[model samples]
Target: MTNDVIIRRTIEWMEGHLHEEVTAEDIAAQAGFSKFHFHRLFQSAVGMSFTEYLRLRRLTNAALALIHTDERIIDIAMHYCFDSQEVFTRAFKKVYGFPPGQYRRQMMSLMKMKEEKQMEETLKGWFLSGSHPFNYEMGADVETVHQGKQSGYLKSKTVTPAEGEFATMMQQFKADRYRGKRMKLSAFLKTEDVQHMASLWMRVDSASEEVLQFDNMSDRPIQSTSNWNHYTIVLDIPENSAVISFGMILSGSGCIWADSVTFEEVDEKTPTTNLQTEIVMLDEPVNLAFEES
Candidate 1:
């Protein structure tokens, strides 16, 4: 079902079944793809995960219902499979930046779910004549500064990179597209120089004894030193593949943070490094930015 017609046809079917309890298996069977790969492929093609797409679609439908009918807000929320009005309100506020009551009061005059084209502009940290909530593209100007006990800054790579190189990176690691690809991603960092460098590489080979492999510099002959900068890499993976083991060779008493990372799965042409979202806060994120204090 590589044909866009088939994929879209299935999406069209999904459009009619928002209230039905849906699962990845159902979509995979309908789309003629393995449940494993279908999830990844769907996101890559639609620029959002199947689960996320479905949720957004449901919310979008609810948005319409909220305005068109005289139905109670609680009824609309429950009809959309939300457990309670409070839960629905929280999620609505998170995504739409306004409660459903406010939206209905606005007379459906505004649409908060951004248009697809708006994503590219929003990626550039721009919105309708201004900035929006998420600004990952702003990373283009964000240099990797020294955050730990180190006294100096880091030599960061140019945030913007080639499309092909980035595409390969995205698909090679996207578990949906790359589950079959089975790539090994490794990261390294050093604090010896005033400037710390973070290097990431991947090797995808199925013929070898180890289908997937990962080894940080601390594991090899490379030693963790006072000049050593600790780093971590999280794989945004599906729950079915959650048990994959992480082999590590830690040298000191710091910490190894193990948590799932979430990311956008855009079209085949989109670059993986070009983050589709970034969570901004006063405190730095350890997952995206490593700490060596």
Candidate 2:
């Protein structure tokens, strides 16, 4: 199987068996990779170690349960395989920047206020537009969130024959802080019956809004149907970059859900998926022969 398929299946298995206590060996076996090799590969592609990813996913699910249900804190902890409430609380706080109890209370309060105000579920810091806005719908959704009671969703509302037609929810901001650095954009995505494809995209732009570096996950497109999975795009923001823009895009028919987006500075060791290729300058042209170096 392709590495992408293997990774997807491994993640699916991890999601289904989150409540169980499984080690790296088990996960590697499930993915059909040796434990040692999988460790490196998983960290490289997913931007985190297997253990860390598993723990964070569990904590994320626990966070959801905390907000959605009235279950006891300790019970929720146990359900996700935490050895004790204290351990769970430490992990949860580290990841979410708040204790479980506090997170629950604060999120519940905010959700309540949103509902009371009858606020439309919309992305606040994003600019939503598309080639055919009339043929698509985009908004934040509370009912079908991946975590924390809300997620940004997009769906094609009407059929269109234009191959170039697309709907996108995007955000752009000054690249001052990230200039001359490698940045990774990671998000969890879920899709349904995608007619064309869906992708998480990022681009570094010059002052004139010309794209300098870009990756729309085109090398490995998310097409057809898919369950919730983590996807990421990494790009270098050159010193000349002025803005960074990114978001989810959908072409043709289908729906996509995006949640838990994150950005981080990465070292050069992380391969960039930028569509632009660097040109190599040769000292002299020599290889006119059939076989020569």
Candidate 3:
């Protein structure tokens, strides 16, 4: 089986059995391997360790449950294997931006609004009452669903790609999957004048740090906006990589803004994609008013 397919299946198992006593060994077994061999391969292939993935999985679960159900905090803590409410609260607060209670309250407000909107639409007899508002509210933001009811989270975004001279600007990643292979992005720099760049900022899946930022530094400055503006960043898709997804941010006065960025790796059978969505990148015109001049 391919590494991406393995990791994807592992996540499937995680979603179904998160309430059980899950371990790296358990995941290794689920993914069809022994711990010793699986650990390294899993980390290298998925860009994250099994344990780390479990923690993230737990946090993601807690966050969703906190909003979806009115279950007691202590129950949530216990279910996710936390030793105490305090511990759960601390970790939840650390992962999300707030305590469980606060997050639930906010989620309720958003869900309420969504439901209200849906109610209005349904009353107009557009569809059937079998549909729900909360579904849209939590869809993308929460667990995975094949089809039917989707979570109510906002979906990915889109933007126009920029153009410069190396000859032309092209959509290289385009939602492609590398499987067990490592892929790199390459763009050309005609000169040494760079006020714009490619950066990768993930939620730093470690409990030890609040956030970590990595900007794949290019050797030359974007001396001129005239060249094709070629640039590239190698993505380390290790089995234990901490990235939720990737994004591209653009800086400059080119009237260019990144829309949603997408890489074609959603399915289990391939290694490349022609589709694109963005976790981050310039899609529309950007506002630098907030940046310090």
Candidate 4:
């Protein structure tokens, strides 16, 4: 299997059995890899060690439970496999900058203020659309931001199991100024329980809306829960390219936050990550006079 597919399977296994005792051996076995090799491969592709990812994911869940559920602190700790409330609290505070109790109260206070406003808030200069808009929810979240005062959150509904459909928070603008230049689109992404994957996608189109270049991070996906990190998509804008449209998309069931999006022009030294090739340069033609070689 491809590394991305293997990592996706491993992540799915980990998410399914989070409450049980797990080791690198177990996860490596799940992905059909040797223990030693899988450790490096997972870290290289996912940008974090398996154990670290698991710990952070469990702690994230615990934090959310503290805010949303009526579970006690010790119970939450035990449920997430922490040895004790003290250990959990230390880890939680290190990541979230607050103890569980204090974090919950702070989150709730922030949420209360958000609840006082309309449930669906636009993301200002961005728009939302997808195959199943009704199956998704979009909003600006202040309590769970990676930078600035808020970030855009996209949530998928549990009832819709359509893997082909996606929810996207997008923005589009004229690309006349960026024509004939290479563009890099990047953003910070944080995800929770991503079943299929989440991606930073960019597309360049003609005046008629025909796509000229595109990359959706499909070759390398964020298939599991992860801490905040940067992801990017780079594509060259042809002289005829008219519109530049980009977005963060969530597939299957999960939640993702997009923060600090940036678009900039780059020189030819930077390679484009566009999946669709505009030209194929071959050493020579393969067929002549319809004769077999």
Best prediction by TM-score? 2
| CA RMSD, predictions in order | 21.1, 5.6, 20.2, 7.0
Q: Rate the local accuracy (lDDT) of all candidates.
A: 0.43, 0.84, 0.45, 0.81
Residue-level lDDT tens digits of model 2 in 88-169: 9998988789999999999888888864321133567776677886787778776555555578888887765378788888
Model 4 shows how many backbone clashes? 0
Indicate which candidate wins on lDDT. 2
Q: On residues 20-119, what C-alpha lDDT tens digit does candidate 3 reach at each position?
A: 8777778889979898787786665445677766676677677777777889989998998888999999988886778989988987787778642442
* Model 3 misplaced stretches (Cα beyond 4 Å): 113-293
Residue 33 of candidate 4: its Cα lDDT?
Answer: 83
lDDT of 1 by residue, 173-254 (tens): 2234545223233222332221221232222233332334332332222222232222332333322332233322222122
lDDT of 4 by residue, 1-293 (tens): 66655776677677777677888788889989898898897775555787887787687668767877989999999999999999999999888899989988988887777544333445677777888877888888756754434688888876556758788888889999998899888676889988889989999999998899999999888877886665667799999998988998999889999877878877887678888875779999887788886
**Colliding residue pairs in candidate 4:** none
- Poorest stretch of ten by lDDT in candidate 3: 165-174
How far residue 6's Cα lies from its native spot in candidate 4, in Å, is 0.5
How close is every model to the real structure, measured as TM-score? 0.37, 0.72, 0.42, 0.61
Runs in model 1 lying further than 4 Å from the true structure: 108-293
Q: What is the lDDT of residue 46 in candidate 3?
A: 45
Q: Candidate 1: count the clashes.
A: 2
Ranking by TM-score: 2, 4, 3, 1
lDDT of 2 at 44: 69
Worst 10 residues of 4 by lDDT: 114-123
Deviation from native of the Cα of residue 278 in model 4, angstroms: 4.5
